[model samples]
Target: MAIDPKSFEAIADLAYRESGLQLVVEKASMIQSRLRHRLKAVGTDSFASYAELVCSDEGLDERRQMISALTTNVSHFFRESHHFELLGQKILPGLIDKLRAGRRFRVWSAGCSNGQEAYSIAMTMLETFPEMAKMDVKILATDIDPKVVSFGRSAVYPERLTTGIPKNLKDKYFSVQKGKEGDEYTASEALKSLVVFKELNLLSNWPMKQKMDVVFCRNVVIYFDADTQDRLWPRFHSLLNSDGHLFLGHSERISEPSNAGFINNGPTSYRPIVAKR
Candidate 1:
């Protein structure tokens, strides 16, 4: 059955409150289509019932499931190549020096979908600076959906999904196995070892105590409202170490960087504005 206007509004409100996803009336059909299976899974015959269950305090787990179903998880290895280039050329040199001085280099791949982004960072660092394998460095890859977090932790991808990975890197970093359908590639142990995948909601309290050197929250906040986006910029700023960089999706912008204690450093890149002592 189609989602009634009231139920759609209720679902939209819940999504906005829990995940900061803006579900507009225009995308009602898309939302309905995506949620059809959810109704069956929850044993609900109508959208109204599903909405009610998800909104109630007792429906916490169901709420998580609903958000997971509705979230868009499209990602590819090196989807935006320039960001990787910037990291290798501009960011890692300084971080390498710090690593040698007994500081841990940390990168957070927020909304890291299926682990491609975090793995890409690992592969790039391991390839460009081979000594990094022995260094104290880690990539924290997080997504709101537990399902995608599990997929990321697996560090396996099918042949089609491996295309975005460069030929040389693919050969160097992934082990290929022939599957019944085609081929599957698993990220090498070195790459997987540097990454930790966890389920996280951006709207919730972040648990990590260590500030990050680089945070890639690309393509995730485009779904949020202006107010939500504004609220997040400062939080990201607070989590970044001095001179640490934050990379957003190509289409997303902070509007005013200084307001968030950041200065525009590159295309879709911002660095925290450290105050002079």
Candidate 2:
């Protein structure tokens, strides 16, 4: 049965309030379609009932499930080649110097769907700075959806999904696993060891204590409103070390870069302005 307009609006509003994800009128049909499985899972015959349950005190977990269903998990290895290039060629060298000087290095892969982005960073770092495998280097990969976090922790993907991965990196960091369904590639232990996967909501309090050298939040803030985006810019700036980098999606920009204490260093890339002594 088609969802009533009232139920759709209520659910949309709830989604926005809870997750800061804007679901406009155009997305009503998409929302209904995605929530159908949740309806079945929750034993609801209609969207109205589902919406009521989601809004109730007892439905907190169901609300999380709803958000998980609504989130998009599309990602691939080396999805943005230029970002990795910048990391390997420009960013890693400076970080390597810090590492040699006895400082720890950290990279955060925010909204890292299914581990590809984090693994890609790991491969790049391991390939460029082989000595890092023995140093205090770690990549923190986080997503709001628990399922995707679990998927990332598994570090496994279908063979077709590995297309964007270069042959050299593929051979070096992944091993083939023959499954009944088809061929699957699992990230090597070396690559997996460098990453820690966690479930985190951007709207919630961040539990990380250490500052990051690089933060990849690409394609995430595009789902948020201008106000939410503006609020996040300063938070990210605070999370970074001196001269730390922030990378956004191709279509996303840090409105008022100077106000956010960031300088547009490259396309969709921002670096925090170093404070003068």
TM-score of 2: 0.98
On the 0 to 100 scale, the lDDT of residue 65 in model 1 is 92
**Candidate 1 minimal-lDDT segment of 10 residues:** 93-102
Runs of candidate 2 with Cα error greater than 4 angstroms are none
The sequence of per-residue lDDT tens digits that candidate 1 reaches over residues 163-276 is 699899999999999987799999999999899999999999999999999999999999999999999999999999987999999999999899989999989999999999
TM-score of each prediction: 0.98, 0.98
lDDT of 1 at 52: 92
Question: Candidate 1, which segments miss by more than 4 Å at Cα?
Answer: none
